[model samples]
Target: METKRLNKAISETGYCSRREADRLIEAGKVKVNGTVVGLGVQVSPDDKIELEGKLISKEVENIYIAFNKPVGIICTTDTSIKNNIIDYIGHPERIFPIGRLDKPSDGLIFLTNDGDIVNKVLRSGNNHEKEYIVSVDRKITKTFIREMSSGVPVLGTVTKKCEVERIADHTFKIILTQGLNRQIRRMCSYMGYEVTRLQRVRIMNINLDDLKVGEYRYFTPSETEEINRLVANSGKTMDASFD
Candidate 1:
């Protein structure tokens, strides 16, 4: 069997994200085959793994969850205090959000144990589109729409030319491939408009139609397979860049 990165193996077991796995491993909390392991180690399926003095017997299972995140809940796994999405969902298997929508923004957020899929979905070069409906404090003019669609400077960088069309007097829909931190809000601010409300409506081909806020649904088997194919194709495309 092929050996996988220790972080990948640890994440597959649903303990935490790969980054978190590194922290645990570096802290001398993880052991493989009765030996305390270090960073950048690889493990195979036959290896026994333990964390924090306990042997982890839980077999990793791939799980995908689509959640309608309501405003206010942070999309983080640091559940040391109050409400976090992880504790809110309460899934038996540990899953992390694919990408984040800000606390003030709410909509379709994907939670899954499929680490490889997350990389594909979030990679900018993959060109997976995220659609959002944003409401501004004032009416949106045609000039403003044109300029916004052209590309606006948020902080030091100019955003890519994205699809921005008016949906209502003060409301518009936008599609973006980049998942910059609080991107939409910052973009609108740069255009001299205060975003009164923002909600992500879609992620790639997935939509949040009829899913109530705070509710979640598992991806169907066919959906899962299709997504896997898309991700695999993306991987091949990325690999060719180095050749």
Candidate 2:
């Protein structure tokens, strides 16, 4: 059997990215057949690979999880600090967030170990829609909605024109394809309004639904398969039909 790079094998398992695996290997955290191997070692399917003495499968099995991230919990892998989602979930399989949710925000957050999908979903060019329910300090006005939908300058660039609708006096819904850091908050603040609450309700077709805060659920096999196929070709590829 042809041998593959240990980093590649580790990444294929949907635990971490190839770059992250390399970091772990360099830090002396990974093992092969009970022996510690350095960077650039290749192992085949027959090999017994381990990470810190834990057996690691070297096949690509896509894992998708939906998490209702609560306020004050940072979406990071750093365990030194308490209230991290990584240690909170405590899944046997290592997984990382597909995207980030600001500490103050709460809502549906997707977690996966599939590096390819992570890259595909996060590529800004793919334009994946993220829907949010935002409540401002005061009543939402038609003028504000139009300005938000018309495109507002933020962080030295203009936010893409978005779908904005006023749901109530103080509540609104916005769907955006570009996810800037603290985007909704920054945009609202730019318009002389304070975002009292911001919650992501949907990512693409996945919705928070009834998943309560701090709760998590794994995606069914069919859902995972469908997502994999959808993201397999994300981003600016050189294939376009002759117009």
Candidate 3:
């Protein structure tokens, strides 16, 4: 195998993203052939790679799973935090969430070992769709829906225009292409409404279906194929504008 950057090699192994791998390397947590390596070091597949003294095998079985996240479960891989999603599911393989869901909100979230796909899906420039069902504190209004669908100012910038539909007196369904921090909640709050409950039902072509809270299942072969097709043209770099 041709020599490749250390971060790229680590990311290809599905252990973490290239950016995260760089952080690990810079912190002296990564060693190559029994010697600590620095950022941008290149290595062949034959060279032994270790992280924190643990051998990192180049061969890893890639996994993609859809999880029905329950409310109060933090969308993080850090095991130190109480009730984090990684600990909740307890999947034996080392996997991490593609994106985040608010702790008080619940529904579908993707967990995977494929770091490359995570970057593609999270990049706002890609315009991937994420669908959600939201319940507000009061009855929905035409003006509320109009303002939400048009755009709302939050985090120092106006949110992108999205699709919003009233589902009930106090419930609505929204589809967004952007993943701003606390986006849905912030948007609702800007419209003089408070989100009483929020649940993500879909991401891209994958839906929550009947998956129970805290349960997870691997994607079907066909589902995986279509997902790849959808993101085939997506940029691998994260958009700082959305951050």
Candidate 4:
């Protein structure tokens, strides 16, 4: 059997992302065959792997869920932090969030044990659309809409041009193909507006319609099939451009 990096092996098990696995290895929390291993160590599928002293096996059943995340709930698997999404859902299996929604924002977010899907969905170069409904502190204006639809500079890079439409005097909807840190919020702030409320309504073909806050449901087989087809050609590696 071919050997793989310790972090990669751990990530494929659906316990966490490769970056989180590296952190655990650096902290001496990962043991291989009863011996703690350092970063970049290689191990095979037959090797014994323990994370935080508990054995981790490759997940046999691939679980995919769409969660209606509530405001103030963080999108992280770290059990140490209070009110993390993982503890909130309390799933029997270990699953990490596919991407993230800021703590202050809420709406549709996906959780899955399939790490390969996580990498594919997060590659900004794939041009997957994420739709959001936002209400700002000030009245919506044509100039604001035009600027938002055109592009906004945030996080040292200009955001990609995307679909933006007014929903109300103070509310609007946007569809983004790229995920930047707090992209919507930063864009509004740059336009002299403060987002009073923000909620994701759709991600690709998945929609949050009628899904209440703090609720979750499994993705139907059809949904999974369609998602797989959408990301079939997306890169499995994390793209640096997304950072």
Candidate 5:
């Protein structure tokens, strides 16, 4: 029987990237035919690769979805959490959210079973854009826009410079490549503004357009192609950002 590297085998199942596979393997979470294996182990196609007691194989088709999340649904894979995004969608495939939206803030978020692409789209270093339409408690000022666009120190680190534009008296558009924790909300607060409402209008090339809150759809052919092209050179590494 032909054999392959363990990490590549895991990635081919669309469960996760080779890096994640290596991590799991080293963590003693991945097993081959009932034996816990280390990194660089090779296994045959028929070898049963189990991760955390769940069988992973070629039959698991990758799923991609653009979900228009409604406020109150938390982004988490743990079913014990009440009103989690997984239970909210109730999809047949065991997919998870790419990033997160605050429990009180919502809009476009991607869900997928294609674990290999998760880091490619979320790493701050990749420079993938996430666009938000925000409404603040007070009128947006020029200084607010300038400071926001420049950078705001938060979470003990300054956020990356981003694109900000005033679209209304109390509302504006902002695009960010980094997904700092509660980054937008904190940035606005630093500018002496409170976000009354925040909705993510876009992530990368996908948009929430016409999708009412809580609705979801699959990506089009062009969207899939363009996204693959965009992330072709992306560094597939995880970061501590919601990005």
Candidate 6:
């Protein structure tokens, strides 16, 4: 029988990526053959791997879900946090949000058990498109459109040029390729405006569509394929600093 690192074995069970498996091991939630094991521990193929006292099966299926996160729900995996996204999702299988939407802001967020794709999708340099409709405390202006689409200085650097268009007197749609913390809000604030409401409507090729707030659905086979293709060249190790 072949021997593998504990993390590799756990990841091979389709429970998570090797990095997440290492996290679980470090958290003291992973055990081998009824005994707690530390990182770098090697095990035979026949050895049993358990996480949180539950046996991890090698045949576990990967899960992908797109959720319309409503306002006030946090984009955190920590169930202990009040109104965390994971608990609200109530998925039978373990899943984590790919990225975050601020607690006060709401829209589409992807949750998945496939840890391999998370970083790729979230990598700021990947230039994947994320669309949003933002409402400001004041009416929209022509100068605002020109300056916002040009670039806005915030978060110690200028935001990348994005597509901005008026959707209403106080609402507009913007598509961004990079995400800095409170980026849109900061940009608007820098221009003497304040974001009153923000909602993400699209990420990459996916859209929130008619999915009501707080509802979720599995990605269609075509959507999954296209997503994979889009991120195929993105490195999984890079920082997903974008929202």
Clashing residue pairs in all predictions, respectively, total 0, 1, 0, 0, 0, 0
Of the two candidates 3 and 5, the one with more favorable lDDT, higher being better, is: 3
**Model 1 misplaced regions, further than 4 Å:** 26-28, 57-60, 235-243
TM-score of each: 0.88, 0.79, 0.93, 0.89, 0.90, 0.83
Error of 1 at 48 (Å): 2.0
Candidate order by TM-score, decreasing, is 3, 5, 4, 1, 6, 2
Cα distance off (Å), candidate 4, residue 17: 1.2
Every candidate's CA RMSD? 4.1, 5.6, 2.0, 2.4, 2.3, 3.2
- Residue 117, candidate 5: Cα error in Å is 0.5
lDDT of each: 0.80, 0.81, 0.89, 0.88, 0.88, 0.86
Shift in Å, residue 179, candidate 2: 1.4
Candidate 1 C-alpha error for residue 92, in Å: 2.8
Question: Over the stretch 1-243, how does candidate 1's per-residue lDDT look in tens digits?
Answer: 899888878776766666667889999999999999899998988999898987765466788888999989888888884678999889887688877877887889899986556656777677778899999998999988898899988757888888999999999999987767678888888888999999988877678999999999988788777777767766312211000
Please, what are the lDDT tens digits per residue for candidate 6 over residues 1-243? 789788766655656666678788999998889999889999997888889989876665677788999999999878889999988988888788877899999999998877777778877888889999999988999999999999988877888899999999999999998878888989999999989899999999999999999999999999999998999998655454456
- Tens digits of per-residue lDDT for model 4, 53-166: 899988578888999999999987788999999999999888889888989999999999876577788888888889999999999999999999999899898988999999
Tell me the tens digit of each residue's lDDT in model 2 across 142-213. Answer: 899999998888878888898999999999999987877777888899899999888998887788999999
Candidate 1 versus the native: TM-score? 0.88
Please tell me which model should have the higher lDDT, number 1 or number 5: 5
Candidate 6 regions off by >4 Å?
A: 1-58
Candidate 4 lDDT (Cα, whole model)?
0.88
